[model samples]
Each structure stands twice: as C-alpha cells, then as structure tokens.
Target: MPERELTFAQAVREALAEEMRRDSHVCIFGEDVAEAGTPFKVLSGLVEEFGGDRVVDTPISEAGFTGVAVGAAMTGMRPVVDIMFGDFLTLTMDQMVNQAAKVHYMSGGHWKVPMVMRTTLGATRRSAAQHSQSLHAWFSHVPGLKVVLPSTPYDAKGLLKTAIRDENPVVFFEDKMMYKLKGPVPEEEYTIPLGVAEVKREGDDITIVATSSMVQVGLGAATLLEKEGISAEVIDPRTTWPLDDKTLIESAKKTSRVIVLDEGYGRYGVTAELAAVIAEGAFYDLDAPVKRMGAMHVPIPFSPPLEDVTVATEETVFEAARQLCGKT
Candidate 1:
C-alpha cells in the first residue's frame, strides 16, 4: 500500500481535531476560527466537529484574545490562540512575555500556562511588510516560551500535537506559503518532542542548518550542490528554544564548514544564534568560520522581484555552500 500524504494545512487540522477529541480542554481561539476556518482555510469544518464552544472565534483583538487564552490555560484550559500572521505577535507581547511566560515561575511553579499560539510566517506571498514577517526568533529569545518551527507536513502534525499538550507556553509558527505543500504522514497518533533536530540529509562537504521554511531551501540547495560534487548535510532544528545544539555542533564538526539559514533577519536572528552555537561548540574542529544567511534586513517589499531577493533561495545557498567548500 502507498503511504498516505497530507498537506501542511491538513496535517495541522488533523492534529487539532485529534487533540480536541482526546481532551475537551483543547480549544481554539482566534478571529474567524470557528465558522470561517481562518484566513488560510486551514480550520475548515473544525468548528462543526468541535462546536463553537471549543473552536471559539473572537473579535479582531490579538492582545485581548491572547490575554484570555493565557488566563484560560492557567485556569485548567488548554487553549490554542491563532494569531493569523506572525507580525501581529507584537500586539500580544505583554501577555505572552510578561504574563503567560512568567505565570508558572512567578507562582513558584504552582501555576501552569499550557497554551499554544499558532501564527504564519515567511515572505514572497506578496502580502507586503505588515503581513509578511518571519519573527520566530523573537519568541525564542524569551526564557519560558517554547518556539516551534515545523518544516514539513509530518513535522507539522507531530510537533503541533506536542505543543498543544505542553506544560509551558508554546509559540508555533507556520509558513503560510507551505500550507499546501504535501508530504507523507502516518495515520497513527504520534507526537514529536520539542527541542529535537532532524538531519534531513547527510553529507561530508558542508552542513546547512536551517529552520522553518528554510529547511526546504536547504534541501533544495543540497540537491543543487550534489551536481557540483558538494555533499551538503541539511539539519532542521524543529524547535528554536530547546534547540538540539549537540546535533548541530556535531554536524559542524564533521563538515568543518557550516551555513545557518532562516527566514528572519540575519542580525540578532535565529541564523546568528545558531551560527554562534556551532562556532562555540565546534570551533576547534571547523575549517572555516560559520556563515549566516537570512532575509535582508529591510521591510519586506511589495514588489515581486524585490521581495523575492529578500529571503534565501536554493541557488543562493548552493552558491554560498560551493564557495565555502572551495568548489569555485
């Protein structure tokens, strides 16, 4: 029998549905999340299955609803707040950073904020600056929050399940452009633990450490590099906060050359932190300094051609890796 496949959106929906069925506390809160199924239609039919009480929709108030979700989680509810766009995370910073993140710690470990906030990231969607920001690194910087970046449909399903059941606050960022991207997923219920890194491809010449949407970018670059006799390893740090630094450092040690790729800005971004980690962990073993590639540090443009150049691509990564490996 052929392995079943699911799009990234479908996988997310399945995870939410299964969790809701298993636990009545697992509810959804966001704008148009109930009947409209969200802007991307990823939540279609969920409200019907779970009903309005569970898959509840609220007014277009991110800060307001996020505060409600935090309170709900603290009071024995596993609430999932959908923030639509990752850029809107700014509005909920106080609730997330000041409240939800510190509730358990401030309460001497008595209070728990088991909440999940789902949002979309990535550029090149033509959504312009306001809607097209990849800001996962912002949440990763917070100590009490777990930041999840699922690169594939399988990862999307498993990691989401884990996030919903986590004991701490979890911020889940999805690439809006990848909702329809398809990949094999198991029918059995399973959850991928946070903080684990998956080595998608193995190689000896160089290591490409990528997160979220950039995982595919790294894979594509690996394929291109293969033709040039450059064996590039691709590793996906599924969660940025509880990052699998050991795996990333080991890969850097083996390859001796490293490239950290992400959709966020390079400076003070996920790419910079990962590069630093690899440099610190594997400095003696490395042959070259770690390289960082990310979105251009500018407001993502509305123009198609200009926006396309802001983020890393397979060709760009291929060229960078080739040069780092002295292929040129």
Candidate 2:
C-alpha cells in the first residue's frame, strides 16, 4: 500500500499505462492522444511505450472512431476511447447507446464489451458551452452503460483501472477542476469496484449526495455546516449509472433529509436522478422533501462570475442543505 501524491491527470495516465502494460488488448484511440497527448496531458508519453499502432490518433470524426472502438471491443479488444470533450459525446451517442451499450445486453449477455470511454468534463477553465459540460447524466440515463466520476487522485487511478477491465462499456468522467488537485494514490495497482458509493464524511443531521466536481463543493459546504452545529453527511456516487441507492437510502433514513448537488444541469440531470431515487426508496424517512441544486438549464457562460453562478458551488450546496434542515 505504498502511496505517492499525484495530480488527477497524472493518476489517469498511470492507470492507462499500467493497463496497457499488463494487457496487450488494451489500446487507446483518440484525437491528439498520440502527439499532443490530450489537452490535459492525460496521455502524455503513452505513445512512446505502447507505440503508434496501439496508441492511435484518430481523425476528428467522433462518430466513425467511436463506432470503430465499439466494433473493436466486441471482437475481444479492450479499447480506451477518449472523447476530447464530454460535450462532443452527442455526436457519438447513437454508436454509444445503440451499439456499445446495448450490443451485449441485446445479445442476451453472451457477448461482453470491455471498453472504457474516457472524457474530460466541467467548466473551471471557462471553455464555454461547446467544450465544457458535465454530461455523465446523459450517459447515466441510458441503460447498459456504466458512468463513473473520480474526484481524487486515488479514486481516479483505481476507478479508471476498473473501467478498463469492466465487461460493459463505461463512460469515465474526469472533472477539469480536479486535473491539478493532488492526492495520495497507491504505487501498486488496484481497482475500485463499480456500483458503489463512497461516504466521504459521516454525520446525522443532513445527507449531501454529490457527483463529479460537486463532491468537492459539497465537502466545502459540509465544513461550514459543521461550524454552525449542523452535522452533514457527504456521499459521492462514484459510478452514476448503477447508482448505489442502498447506501444513499440508508444514510438518508438516518438523517431523515437529503440534498443532491450535481455539476450537471438541474433538470433531468444527475441531481434529478438522485432526488427521484431517494423519494422512491426513502420516502417514509423524510423530515422534508428531498432537494437538488445544480447548474441552471442554460448553456455554460464564458465570464468567470457568470460561470460561478451557472455551476453548483459551496453557496448553492449550503443553501440547499440549510433549507432541508429548516435552518434557512
């Protein structure tokens, strides 16, 4: 269990490197992954180790390359497909939803797709609407797809390894805000199992369920709530698709109230999903109705101040929690 401090991007690169070295079937294909090594340097030096044939640099055709990756996965290759930005996933939705996700299930579980779809998300750099978005919600809504978001270096490495080896097509989201944040990650290899929720903080007053970048914001808000004598429990649903509703429901039953914070839009996004699930599973334990806070349903703005308002943050989480606890 030896550990080293590394940024989120470095952790992702390490996971890919380790997987590629261990399995010959593991190949990476993405635009600029070979030469430019990705905008966040997540694939830096991978081409040198795995060579150009394995670390392929595809054209800008997301649809074509994604479909190609799906076909490769079906035939026994474990391809780590990288979409430059989560926003561009829309172009390959048909291939991902109809093909990659559904193929194995449609085939009566006889076939398995061990493919990982890696993409960068969030708007910390002000990349605007086209390049910046938290679209895990989209992938989560589709059945047969696994969605994962790692907020720390350790989880980033372990979850990516799990996604690479998983039997189903997984959409792995790396929040741009976490790319530079450093944390303790193991030197030896490890994999975090999917369909699990990690309770980062435990408390009895209120429960905060967050995903992706909002995990950090929820933690920050939890600290402030602690000072005000409001104990806050924070839960990160690391994998969104097969969400660990049992853990969340148990926590909510103890606390009797829940607030869901998400980086995606408020309407029909990750937050919406959590709220719906809690309402369904833990309705009797509620002191008040479940609450959700997230970015407005509009496109991400460019200005820093505007972006601050558009995305969920500590203020938003605090207000939502306060309202749920009857302290607002």
Candidate 3:
C-alpha cells in the first residue's frame, strides 16, 4: 500500500469514514459534528456521505448525549461520541465512568459497551482554561476504560480503528494543537492494537517516554541532544492504561536513565505513572533519578505567554534530558 501525506485531522476523518463504511453498526453523535462538521472541521462532509442517521449532531448537553451513546452501544451498536473539549468530560462522568465502563463487568460479560469517546486536549489554541486541558490521566485511573493518546497521523488513524472495534469502552484523545500537523499514512486499512508502545527514536544514553503532543517535543529534544554527543531514545506509550510495560522497562533498563514527559499537570499525572513503572520494573539498572516534566498544576491560562509557560516544550524536555545525562 502506498502512503500519502495527511494532517492529523484528515487521518482521523479518514478512519471514521472507513470504519463507518465497513460496519453498519457504527454511528457518530456530537455537537456541531454533522452539518457544522465540528470546530476543527474533522467531520466535514461525513454527514453528507453517511447521511444524518449515522452521522448525527447532538445538543450541547454532554451528559445527555453521552448516556444516549452508552445506551446505543449496549444494544449492539458501536457509537462514537465526540466531546468538543476535554474539560467537558467531567460533566459526563456518570455516563462514562459509572455506566459505560461498568456495564460489561457488571453484566458478567453478557453485555458490552463497545463505544468510543473522542475528545480534544492541550493548550495553545487560546481556547482558555475551560476548553484547553489534558485530562487523560483522570480516565487512565479508571478500570474497564481504555485510554488512547495518539501523537502521529498514522497512530491516530490506526488506533482509532482499533478503538471502534474494541469490546471495552475506549477514551480516544487527540491533541488539539496537532490537528494540522501532517505525516505519512497508508491508504490501505490497518489497526494498531491497544497497549502497544512505539519507539519513535532509538538511542542508548537516556530514555525519554512521552505521550500525546509531547512525543513531538521529545523527538525535538532528542535531535538537539544528538548534536551535544548525547543519544536519547524516545518512546510513545500509545495507550495510557494497560501500558506496554515491556517496551518502556526494556528501554529504561538498556539506557539506565529515564525522563517521562506529558502535557498534563506534572503532579500525580501520567508522568508520575511512567516514572513509577520504570522505577519498579528496572530499579537495578538505574543510573540516575528519573525526571518528569509536564504542565504546571493550575488551570491553563488564556494569556499566550502564561499558557506557554504552563505546558512542556521542546526546550524544557531537552533541558530535562541534559540534566539527567549530566551534560548540563
């Protein structure tokens, strides 16, 4: 299959189109998703293609539409519910956490809520504190829910296809800042299994584990570190929960130095989980204390300068890698 260049949003739209075509049971519902095509326009023309029945536009009530999606999934339909912003996920916790996530387990595997909750995260769009936030950590802590954070176009498309087919409910998070970022994607069909981690770059001096948009930052840091005689390995844990521990633990054991990066708040966030995993699985191979970098513990500010300081950047990740490698 030949690969073509596609922006992150295009890749996601392609996945949804292909999945909806392949499965009659698959449907989508969200605010401004049908005719309006969403704020990012990722769903533009999809409603025209699949018609209003499959591609639906719901009201502004997150909890109400989310419950409807869950109910639809329970009845053997695969519903893709799109939350316009990550912050709005808090409003649908009852439907998501208490209902959708528990139905399969509570029913003793007799029923399954094979649903996909797609939402956007990160700050920099100036959407302000309410619209811009990375809350994947909150969902990752919940059992019976699969958390997916795709950083690249290829992963975004493939992982989403897999999520739509999953028996358990999946929380799919797309970085809002990466919508226009382009990467090569195959025209042919593919599905990247959950719980698999990818090594974006390989080295031996230090290991850098990053999630979502921070994967790109980690890559940038690795490129700069290379010129300074430091070889940094970069890993992207595509799925937050049920993380591919083998890949991360092996990398940490090989490099003996690790730095975990995330766009979420640093305190008690995804970085903390990765750091703990590395420390527990590869303690004997440690060379230096594991470092973590993420957004500060505060609501993302509306000011460009203030918001810029809150999130992790390539420079911050590079500096963290330098200090860990003793090159600073």
Candidate with maximal lDDT = 1
Report the lDDT tens digits of candidate 2 across residue range 33-81.
9978997788999999889999999999999999999999989899999
Over all chains combined, what TM-score does candidate 2 have? 0.97
**Considering summed lDDT, which 10 consecutive residues are worst modelled in model 3?**
319-328
Lowest-sum lDDT 10-residue window in model 1: 319-328
- TM-score of every candidate relative to the true structure: 0.99, 0.97, 0.98
lDDT of 3 at 24: 95
What tens digits encode model 1's per-residue C-alpha lDDT throughout 180-204? Answer: 9999999998999999999999999
Can you tell me which runs of candidate 1 are displaced by over 4 Å? none
Stronger candidate by TM-score (2 vs 3): 3
lDDT score for candidate 1 against the true structure: 0.96
* Segments of candidate 2 deviating more than 4 angstroms: 1-3
lDDT on C-alpha atoms for all candidate structures: 0.96, 0.90, 0.94
- The TM-score leader among the candidates is 1
**What does candidate 3's lDDT look like per residue over 1-328, in tens digits?**
4569999999999999999999999999899999999999988989999999999888899999999999999998999999999999999999999999899889899989999999999998898899999999999998899999999999999999999999889999999889999999988889999999999999999999999999999999999999989999999999997799999999999999999999988899999999999999999999998898878999999989998899878888888888888875
Better of 2 and 3 by lDDT: 3
Query: Alpha-carbon error at 274 in model 1, in Å?
Result: 0.3
Worst 10 residues of 2 by lDDT: 311-320
